[model samples]
Target: MLPSGAFVLVVIATVILHCNGAPTNCTITLQQYTTIQIGWTQQQVTQFLGSPGIIVLEVGTAGSPYQMISVQYSALQSSSATASFLFMGGSLYTKSQAGIDAGVYTITSQQYTMIQAGWTRDQVTNLCGSPGSAISESGTGNTASVSVMYTVSGTPYASVSFTFTGGQITSMFEVGLSPPVNDKITLLQYQTVQIGWSQQQVTQFLGGPGIIVLEVGTAGSPYQMISVQYSGQQSSAATASFLFMGGSLYTKSQAGMDTGVYTITSQQYKTIQPGWTRDQVTSLCGSPGSAISESGTGNTASVSVMYTVSGTPYAFASFTFTGGQITSMFEVGLK
Candidate 1:
């Protein structure tokens, strides 16, 4: 896929007009379309479509969408446009639009891996971490500037696009979408802990043990560090400063550098899923402060935490999560 826009092309299961699953009638499944949205990279698409066959990109195409990126795929032996995915920007488009026939959408005519669709926002976030970035349509019905884009680098991969409207995804297309320039696929998972949540709840969500507390500096200037893992093991350390005298909280992680006084209103701070893109964090937490830390691989990353109240940076406190949900948090500051 190109950097112009990001989209997911998934084949869906819908009633194909009058086809009765007959031998002559080509059977199309919606699986391909849905799978693409869950962050299925171009390599995965290649496994299903086999060599794009035809690749196209229109620079400044009129009438349709600006900075349009698209890819056309053939079913090896078939010479017709079986199916395709379209990406307007970071948000995926749908095939449910007019003129698109569910029966002949070539993208699903062949065989490949399977990924289920109809997942909730949280479910998709949990599975694919967060989109590199996301862009929504303008209120005036015009296209918005491309934010998060997808690339395919140099491989038999397709830039998949997924479109959502009225809360639910409406259509999907494989062609007319940009193939990413870098085909590297990055996976992120969020582990959460909430305030008042017990160790059992933490383990149930994060898979247990890996969670540890470490002390920093001397007894008089001591601080605590919280560490947890996602898919594999996390070798990074997250510091949480409990200022008993000032009644303030401090935390740091591998994502970003953030500092603010928090209140330990509650003794327990739950750890939620982590590894969220800036957009995802903003959508949930607004423009809150950031936490900086290093991953197990020593990779530096930022963690964004938003405060429930707005005022001084350290005047308010909020719970932090890796992805979307709240992880571990504490209340600080004297009433």
Candidate 2:
């Protein structure tokens, strides 16, 4: 059953089930992920993620004196990605993620309760972990404002975030770290899976995002890779893993994804080479490929993107640009 004003979501992700229409697609990348921040409104997040999120949990009735909501953006294309957000009065209060830093976290639900205002950054780091993933920051010197998040990796996923003014904590937030969940995938559901499906499509078909089990390569890099595991029909011990490359289903031990469907063909990829202008590559490949990671400004700008093609021997192309010209390039999982 659903609370008032809440839409149905996921067959097995949580208690609610059934939906009125096709669920909104939530396909995200590493670069897009960084643009999100705490305090953003639901409309803002939906615009960035490409659709309104399914209202997973809503507390109190529509006009109740108190209200809160928890929403999720599932099975992202970014390496080792997972996003969970909480809102109060329709405004974001807390958010968490994995694979943004490519570093392991050990923060627990128990530790989250200890976080308090006026604590020094060092005290929180000693209790949680040093150098929590920097969510956002502004200003400089002693007046600086910064927010950091610490996550508990692996089972019972959880995390905590803190905001500081000057060098002292001002506010804190956290999410997840609850008990494990049932992914609700069966052999029959698995049969419907196909190569090259977007993460959102897989989630829609399978009924949930499953657990993010493996994160390879660094965050914000072309080499980054993420694998998600779901339960099998046989038993809890028998699980399934899906590897994603560039936000598309790359592998499940069946046929690989059709990267060429979204990116360039082998012939177009070859036409792009070192020293080629960004426009030239776009002309040759039809698109510049999805920008995975980028930095700098104006003439000093540097960007990195991925171009994947179907077929064998020549797939998975990565390109780096500086000053709008190709600076470096590489490939992944050549077969």
Q: Pick the candidate with the highest lDDT.
A: 2
> CA lDDT, every prediction?
0.32, 0.62
Q: Write the per-residue lDDT of candidate 2 for residues 258-281, one digit (tens) a residue.
A: 122446665666566888888888
Which regions in candidate 1 have their CA more than 4 angstroms from the true location?
Answer: 1-31, 58-68, 74-81, 87-164, 168-335
In order of appearance, the predictions have TM-scores of 0.19, 0.30
How far residue 60's Cα lies from its native spot in candidate 1, in Å, is 8.3
Q: Which whole-number lDDT from 0 to 100 does residue 117 have in model 1?
A: 25
User: In candidate 2, where is summed lDDT lowest over 10 consecutive residues?
Assistant: 253-262
Task: Give me the displacement of residue 157 in model 2, in angstroms.
Answer: 14
lDDT for 238 (candidate 2):
52
Cα lDDT tens digits for candidate 1, 1-335: 54433322121122122122221233223444334442234445445543432224544554444444444433323434244544454223422211112232112211101112222334333444444223222221232221221222342354334333333223222322221222111113222332334334444554333212222222222232222222222222222211111111232233211234322222122222344444544454435344333122112222445443444335445444444444455445424
- Clashing pairs counted in every model: 97, 3
